[model samples]
Target: MNHRMIDRNREEGHARLYRDYFSDAPTYTETHFRRRFRMRRSLFLRIEEAVTTHDNYFTQRTDVVGVRGLSSLQKVTAALRMLSYGTAGDAVDDYVRIGESTTIESLKRFVKAIVEVYGDEYLRRTNDEDVSRLLRENEQRGFPEMLGSIDCMHWKWKNCQTGWQDRSHLFEDLAESHGPKVRYTVNGYEYNMGYYLADGIYPSRTTFVKTISKPQGKKRKYFAYAQESVRKDVEEHLEFYNLDLQ
Candidate 1:
């Protein structure tokens, strides 16, 4: 497909997916810059600031080399090609009319710049809020403690060495499962349900408690006993109830 046409279509598809999976609420004036997710703005600028501050000379070399520092921009273009459309190196050349070596270098530079600059500082660790406050702050359909659901997917990831880290005894897990380059689910298994809920694929969204009844049994044992909020947070959110959510 023509690169222009493909990019246009990809942008449209992303907008559609965002609309479907998430709601776009009216902009709240109360929101501050720090309060908002920085994704909507330029993160590369932040990385550049860090480099210049620490006298990372590579930034200066690549940024101003050959026609006013097209290096960063080139890598960004290359990375976006793969990230947006899953296009390989040759495919990127076909689209951008760039040489294969240039394309490969673009990818390498992009990866190096990204890793060396921004790391896990970009990930959201956790949020600590009581159930009542959580409900009042950001009430969803009904599920309060309920955050998100899961759907099964299969992926053919590249690289065996990196794939070895499976969250178990890293070394032992590596040794235990070694063979025909097979891709397994990240958290595979029924009882492997990370949440407190039983492992079954009612493959659902979420539904909060229907009644305000007291915690009655094992699932509802919270009534008679005041469990530590920390423990509750630590445990899976979907444990209580006979309702096998579908």
Candidate 2:
């Protein structure tokens, strides 16, 4: 093998990589950048500032020969694209000017910075004020004393047991087996607590109000219709809130 030829080939490879993947400005408009990164340019700049301040890994550096390396913008853009689309690191190389290994490192540093900077504000448990506000808002929805609704969903567990486990542990702290201890009256019957609307598969505790499978009397039928309607409204409201947050 010719050593000089091998060296020439290697240098040519590096030149092509720099030209094709890391030469100039990203080939995307602001709108496209927002769509791909899931944030506006202004927001991206703010986040870039935070990330760069928190970790020097995101900051741009000069190469050994005084050439400028990748900027913080390119590294963060690569990382955000990977996260927003759940794509592989190399998938963004063509547009973001990032290699797969560097993209992965950017992702790790970005995540760590986010956790360090915003975790305290966003991850805290609900406090007394939150609970009070929830109770007040829920009372206006016609279900007086109601706290919140609970439901279980089945996820595909590739290696776990297929059978569902009871989630009674969630309510273990509550004194009453039926539900919240707030008392309210309905149809001349006094109840000692608010109840969650659940499916029949849930236990027959007072905390859960399941729909009637066989409604014989007019009262039972009316109750079943009303309960299901209220449940639907709550679910729709929650869906809207989630969309707004996104």
Candidate 3:
């Protein structure tokens, strides 16, 4: 009874070894590969080359007994599927032909390789050119010298310290806003410049422009419409960027 059980387990483990799921044939075309991996074939191949070149762990090799390991494409595709869909490691076994533990290890190694290779170029600090470009783009959107939008989001920290829980005083500089505070002076009359649009939770600072709850005059209505529209554009851009990454 135990001998048959061991044989069955061994057969099942090798079932995915010869499946042509990752092949470039009619069954699994390049188009299907790109859709599932969320990247073009060329880009995937480029990344594979970079990863295998940078780290020997990702390189395909044969064991002492002549058993061949997974290819670079197989490992990268498994990792990319998990990253794209946030699925369990075992979920990719059928298509990528990689075991759950191996898939998870591939993901860890893939991410490490990406950060090591492209972190500096993509994660560099903004320089003068970047600042100028931001200001110019915002100026075209009726906001001169504006850097970017500012907002806070809450993140749940499971193991947060008690001392870090009640640190509202850290945001003391962002005190509640008062209505119609003068930001800058143009000739004699006061002019508000370099302001950001925020939600009602923020205090009425001259730097922050909140939507008016009730507007009686046409000018106020127009201002509210324009402000909300521009603010929506910023929100939509962020959402688009996130979706593209996913």
Candidate 1, pairs of clashing residues:
63-69, 196-236
Cα lDDT tens digits, model 1, 1-246, are 653422223233333323432235423321332123211113333543444444333242423434333233333454545543456676644433444555676656555555455433321222333223433322243333332222111212222224523422322232343211222233362221112111132222122112213656775565223333322332323221111121
- The digit string of per-residue lDDT tens for model 2 on 1-246 reads 553311123234334434533356544566665554555555666778889999998777876977566778777777877766668888866555567788899999997897687656543444556456656877777666666655442222211112222222334433236443566788798987666776565656777777899898998998888777777666434421322343
**Local accuracy by lDDT, each model:** 0.34, 0.62, 0.60
Worst 10 residues of 1 by lDDT: 190-199
> In candidate 3, what are the lDDT values of residues 1-246, reduced to their tens digit?
453311123223333432434334435566665566655555666788889999888887877977676777777777877876778898967655678788899999998898788666543444566556666777798766554554442222221223233433213323432222225554485664345676666555665667787876998898778777777676445422322343
Give the runs in model 3 whose Cα sits over 4 Å from its true position: 1-34, 131-246
Q: List the residue pairs that clash in candidate 2.
A: 178-206, 178-207, 179-207
Which candidate achieves the best lDDT against the true structure?
2
Q: Residue 141 of model 3: what lDDT? A: 84
In model 1, which runs have C-alpha deviations exceeding 4 angstroms? 1-69, 94-97, 123-246
Q: After superposition, how far is residue 77 of candidate 1 from its true place, in Å?
A: 1.8
